[model samples]
Target: MLYLFQQILNGLHMSALYALLAFGYALTNGVVRRTNLAYGALFAFSGQTMILVAVFGWHVLWLTLPATVALGILAAFAYAALVGAILARSVFARLAIRTPNAIVVATHGVALMLMEIGRIASETRDFWLPPLLAWPVVFASQGDFRATLTVMQLINVGAILLVLISATIALERSRFGQRWRAVCDDPKAAAMCGVDVPAVFRHAVLAGGLAAALAGILTALHFGNVSFGTGLVFGLKILFVTAVGGYDSPPRAAAGAAIFGMAETLWSGYFPIEWRDAAVFLGLVALLVLRPGHEETRVAQP
Candidate 1:
């Protein structure tokens, strides 16, 4: 019983992480109204940039917490922005209106290109952040055992929640939110109503790219590292998770992602760890086949 509660507590962090990344997916899909395959690669690019920054010892040269974090942010977001901008101008701009399949294929190519670039740039080296806040904070103790989480984990959870809240509020009150909702609902209608549909999509793609970068840096900070190869796999996980909750609604996507994170954690805790991913993914696949929010999640016609 104690262990189960501990597991739940542990799952909270992972659940928040899922919400963060899925938020990025929701942002992109909300505006483009189509699946953009480049997102996972953008995440990997951010992670790889962080690895390179650490490799270069820039963090040590900065000599301050804010400066160090700023360096990391610069590296992560710069690469993400550059690649995202390229995708927006070169690929999505030219292909999205005419050949959606081409957009998919082209984005896949871009993803592969980013992965290869990351692999080559890092020289296939592995780097992780030094254990910054490794102290465990005990929340509950059962006799001789204490359920604990690191201070960094708590901080990460808090930071992620703050970001989620701020973004949610901005979405409700900001012009981008209104335009995003309009475009997602009906692109032609939005264009007819004087919304620059293309611009909205580009902005959404950029915003989503940055969101993925933020998630990458945060996850790297928490876990100390990221796999360059996780781009597509992570993106797909976000996709399945959001699909369950309705990708058309960012709130729903976040909720669904949080649920998946909890379920995944619990499954690993109580069942065969090796089968955890298989079981979760298969379950999601079954749910996806059902696709509960089909009408809400349908892609808007270009």
Candidate 2:
């Protein structure tokens, strides 16, 4: 029973992570109709930038928890926006009129470049955050077993879910959301109707960048640090995870990613941890192959 309860807590953390990740990816891809694989690298890079800032005396400004969190969020978003802008200009620019596939292929190179930049910027130093909010909070207790989770876990999960919900609302009801969907359905038509296609693209990337930044920040805060080399693997995992959920809708994709996260956490809990990644990857691959979703089912126009 205790194990069951603990697994639920563990799954909650992972579910939040994957949900935010999927929403971030879908935010851009669903609207832009182009996959920016550099997104994962941007995510890692943003977190690295925040850590580098802290290591360089920014931590001195941590006068209070709210202050620290606000500064951290600002740092994350700043770096993400910087990277996103660069990618938008260099790799993602003019794709609608030029060649869409070129941009998709270019994102691979951009991802590698960002990873190298992150590695070089780190200077081979570890940027582990001093543990924050480490106190455990108990939920329920048995005679000898207690269901507990860390304060960081609760904060991370709550904050991520909140962002996800807020983004969903924005996408569904806001003017930008209306424009985003308009662009998604038909960019040429959207443009003809006064939707600034370029601006829409930029906004989508920035929105996605913010989402990725938040995810990276939370993961780093919870796990101590994220490796500079983790961007590719993280990107691939998120790519497949979001694929499982389909890219047509942000909310549905988030739900799918959440389900994958919970399943992964449970598998890790009951099985050999060493094989968990392999098993999860293989399972996701098998599912993707057997049932191709929106991206796969779409008939490309020539």
RMSD of each: 2.2, 2.8
Report lDDT (CA) for all predictions. 0.80, 0.79
How far off is residue 123 in model 2, in Å? 1.5
- Candidate 1 structure quality by residue, lDDT tens digits, 1-302: 87988899889989988898889789887755566777887887797687577656554574455456567778888888887787767777677667766767787888888888888887787677777687999988989888888898899889889988988898899998998899888888888999988788788778878888888887777777776787878877887887777767787788889999999999989999999888999999999887644644434333
Q: Once superposed on the true structure, which residue ranges of model 2 sit more than 4 Å away at CA?
A: 58-72, 292-302
- lDDT at 282 for candidate 1? 100
* Candidate 1 C-alpha RMSD relative to the actual structure: 2.2
Supply the global lDDT for candidate 2.
Answer: 0.79
Q: Deviation in angstroms for 37 in model 2?
A: 1.8
lDDT of 2 by residue, 163-259 (tens): 8888889988999999888777777788888888788777887788888888888888888787787777778888888887877677888998999
Return the TM-score for candidate 1, rounded to 2 decimals: 0.92
